[model samples]
Target: MSGPRIDPSLYRERDRIPIRRAILSVSDKTGLVELGQALAAAGVELVSTGSTAALLQEAGVPVTEVASVTGFPESLDGRVKTLHPAVHGGLLADLRLEDHERQLDDLGIRAFELAVVNLYPFAETRASGAPAAEVIEQIDIGGPAMVRAAAKNHANVAVVVSPDGYDGIRRALAEGGTTLEQRRALAAAAFGHTASYDRQVADWLAKETGERDRVLRVEATLAAPLRYGENSHQQASLYTFAEGRGIAQAEQLAGKEMSYNNYVDADAAVRAAYDFERPAVAIIKHANPCGVAVASAKTVDPIASAHIRAHECDPVSAFGGVIAANRTVTLRMAEQVADVFTEVLVAPDFESDALAVLSRKKNLRILRLPADYRREGWEFRQISGGVLLQTADSFDAERGSAQHDSSGWRLVSGEEVDDATRADLEFAWRACRAVKSNAILLADGGASVGVGMGQVNRVDSCHLAVSRAGKRARGSVAASDAFFPFSDGLQVLLDAGVRAVVQPGGSVRDEEVIDAAKRAGVPMYFTGERHFYH
Candidate 1:
């Protein structure tokens, strides 16, 4: 493994290295001809690989093929093109080091002042859902080797990995040469580009082979700088996953810039509203759902009606809350939405008239969901010294799908309910999971009448729900995210004239809870599945 001896004292320091020769090999042909022409006009030698050399020669630019320098033709379907020592030695030779210069001169290898390389489209090929073999072929071997070699010897060479840097490289060449600082910055960027590309390939291979990475490679690019963090005094920024389909990809149709809180509440609203099969709307405030509702079959304007009912659940809290709708926003929805002092509204799309109406409210943020948006993958939460990862809370109850399996549900007490009340209980159960625990939700006519969330005790949550619902709780069905430790919470709902209840019954005092429901003559169903959100 030992290759050569090092003599630090014999190495000289240089500020700017004149670029007399450049190696350019790119899979992306964008701006390649122009860069070649400019380098030729500047009297710089251009050495390129197969197709790149052909394109430059066709454009009337003088160029030398990499095969001519290596004395070996590109073999193994071009996979072995730039892996030879001639290319790497030229790229990695430290002209400041006397030994390195002597080795290059004795070997008849010309040192390259610049290396421009962009890897093949591995990420794009994988994203296109191409076959495994096709995706594998797009993983460039020689390109990364060249980029890393040039970046490692940044003191003697500059590397460019993207077309965006072509202009800067051209300007640097026009200025005689690139400064050491410029080379260092380019080296850092080049390494990052290769790192992200490798991570993508590794992650995809892991998924295809049904294996998990022992060491996670998390990568994100800076999307924007937020005005502040959770509070005004704190600093914050937004980093987006390159292939994410969540809030980061949402398009703002019309509105002011999104704040930190706006994105948080908007994301929560979207998740809550999309839980239903029918047209639904969820109003969220401070990362908690203020109200949630779904439209009935007879509704005239489904989204508008759902929004109206959801807002009515807690009109006071919904004043400046964010709204998310599962369906498109129509003119009717826009008119009703404009009447309220809302902060943000996100939906799949907006009708022409609806957009015109919503655009009038300059301060109201209007976001359109990405067409292919879907909730998938894992959820990550960071703690003081570690991170927690789990699969997302997803179910088979997607929109337009068959109803979720209810064979696991058991009617523990009271008489069996009609179809209408059963539908209400089902809606309440799904909505309750989105609320923070200890959570209690009341539903009637496919809409939330009251919601009690984030309480320390189930009994307090029950009381809060009843208090918020007032008279509406009389005929509403109740859903608890988890089982009641005692009968006190069920008693509270029963006392408010709640007609039926749905909960995950697994407490030691389950019989006691069942007795209380039986005495109230209220139907109680145990799903045996608990959902607790914190």
Candidate 2:
């Protein structure tokens, strides 16, 4: 069936719509008084609801209460005030039609040329750990409805949804009215604001009822536009979530602006460094860890020692790599880093003296982690026709359990070592998770000696690790992110004089791998959990 059509002459083509009247309602009172006074000075009639009316009157701006226009008191705890025809009729009216104008005059309804609204803080209320009832009450009904009505009729009305738009609106009013182009832009932003608000509310309710898969609503605002993406030809920009601090929200203290590659490497370095409880440092290149190390028992200037040890694992790869430290960057660590050509350095903070020393390098990007920074929420990867989502990889389940502690791991071969060697094995297991699979990491004295990552096969990864370690591979403990599918990979490490090994041990050839370690008189432990970072 054909849809109903209207004559084109019935629609108005307005270049500018004068603000003869407006409805002001906001949960946030920022710039409210100033806006009200400006409207009064322009001889614009103001119709406001509840607290908005009272606040405008207090500021000595003439105003009419919504109750006066609706001819009924705000009932049901003020929820029914703006739902009446007197309010919506004005916002949704087609002023270009003579029939609509006659009906408005007969019903004592006046058309509104503008609407200033901001919804209740549903996202902030829920994030504050408020009770379910309290948070639910913050879900705005009238505000979004009014906003949608005004925005839909934006040909004759301008809607402002944020305080940041106040100055622009004021300037437009001073120039006689808002142009159709300006109104269209404001309408677009209004719809986006409401969409994000509804998404937040819907997502929270889904979680409350244990129906997380019911909907997936992602909202973000552009933080900045980069020069390019991974390559100069591709376009890229950074976007930040409404709440929470992450790489996008981190404060850049010095150096050049971050690039697409810099954020990726910086985030990987942070994940690798913060995986340990002790002071730790990680150096990353191309989203793969080149070096990772934790503090040793006998280290003075523990963080500095960790940086030096991490860098020594693969000094050549560490060049131009991004670095992350779990603790504050001190002068001792900064001095050592100043010698290396690094792309980015991220830490919780930097000591004053440390900043003074590192600021000399003009092109090195330095980022300070946000307060209470956390890596949580689902990780997303895009494919050709779909997206893959999973909970962020974390050690919460294995944090203090047998999986992270060597005492709880199943010893498949050889005798157990002392405290120091056990510490090395634990650090190796955790650090290997940050490497790309097929991955192998070798560590001694709580520091990585070599890392093999992003290889096609486990045997190749083993060779890469041993070759990187050189003589340091002797007596070093090795960790495989996943089980060695065959004995050949295990033999490579065993032949390299590796004294001990840790792996998930789920492959069908686990028995053969254990037998290989047993023949070499090396301790082999199974974590039963594999971390494959593709």
Candidate 3:
């Protein structure tokens, strides 16, 4: 298993190797022309392939084509251009080893001191629903090969793989080449780039061809470096996929930068807000909603009323929590929000006057999302060493679709369900879907009055909700994510003055629970569906 043994004599203290020649081949030519000019001005030879060389030539920078370097014309539609030994040997040579240098000289292989390569847009191509031929063509061969070679020889060669890195590379070369530390960092990035590129290709091929690969690979690029994670002791960064916009893409219009917990809790807040088509607001603390409320139609100032009622649900817990509104934030809403110690706020848009008022809170993190911003694609959650993927829970119970939706909800007992109660039950059920396990969500009229979660017993969750809502528990509809295994939970809700209930009623004691609802004179509906989140 052992390969070549290292010679201690080869180790020597020296400065960075002068970047004498660079091989540049990129699908993303951003900053390419300027970099070529800077390298040429610094007396560095530029060798490129295909349109890259043509671009440099057009820009008046001297560029030697790969065909000229290898003494072979590009064949197979430019695929064979950089596969030549002349291109790879130049990138992989270890200047520290005398034998490597001798082999390079004897074989007339030019050692490339720098390599700039960004591979074909395979991920973009595959994501765009491109045909098999187009996706196959985007599986870059020579680009990854050269990137790996240059990265493996990090001691003497510097590799650049991202356009974001172009400016720094140019500045380094112009200021006196790259440092050993920087080269090592670039080498690590290069390996990661090729590995991610290959992973995307593998994923696309396996899924498109219906080959169920056992292993899972999730790839994403760095979005932002967070100030800290959930705690000050931990480090964290944000990563985003190539497809759609997420919390990382939200604009920080006028506030301090968001931390790790801010992004996490903010996403929860916004999701709860988006679930409601009406003017809604969600107040979240520790990834759980403290209160969620929608403005009543009778309110003259809907946004302000939504915020005030949501905060009233649990004013103590709403303190320092993230708040999100599906509607534009108005000056009146801003004035009400400023009265509380809100840590973060997210809105579709903000009136200029609202921003003028909210900007006074220097520590408050405010974010603005496009009115149409919504998440698409799969949901991913990581365990110890693997990932769990599923389509997001886009299951919103249509206002009256419950009668026709497969899991058709029907009234099971007690008084006839009124329209107002039905609307409130729907709101509570939607909010309950977002709560943690053993959840019991209570809604008064249209606002989320109380939320009880993370309990081992359903009865205890009922107790928590009743206690949280206080007097508001009277006449408020309740939603239990799953069936009440025992009738005791239903009795507890009834004792707290809950008039109606919604739950997925399929349990060993379903008859007993329905009997309990009937005896308590409460209207109960069986959704024929359960929503348990942990």
Worst 10 residues of 1 by lDDT: 398-407
Instruction: Assess every candidate by TM-score.
Output: 0.92, 0.94, 0.90
Candidate that beats the other on TM-score, 2 or 3, i.e. the better one: 2
RMSD (CA, Å), each prediction = 2.8, 2.2, 3.2
Model 3 C-alpha lDDT per residue in residues 301-403, reported as the tens digit of each score: 8888888888888999998999999899999999999989889999989999999999999988989985558775567888998778886675544433452
**Cα lDDT listed for each candidate:** 0.91, 0.91, 0.87
Top model by TM-score, which number? 2
Candidate 1's displacement at residue 100, Å, is 3.3
Q: Which stretches of candidate 1 lie over 4 Å from their true place?
A: 1-13, 16-19, 37-43, 54-62, 128-132, 205-210, 397-407
Model 2 lDDT tens row, 105-142: 99999999999999988988998999999999899999
Task: Please report, as a residue range, the 10-residue window in candidate 2 with the lowest summed lDDT.
Answer: 396-405
Candidate 2 residue runs with Cα over 4 Å from true position:
1-4, 57-62, 212-215, 298-300, 398-404
Query: CA lDDT of 16 in candidate 1?
Result: 81
lDDT of 3 at 154: 90
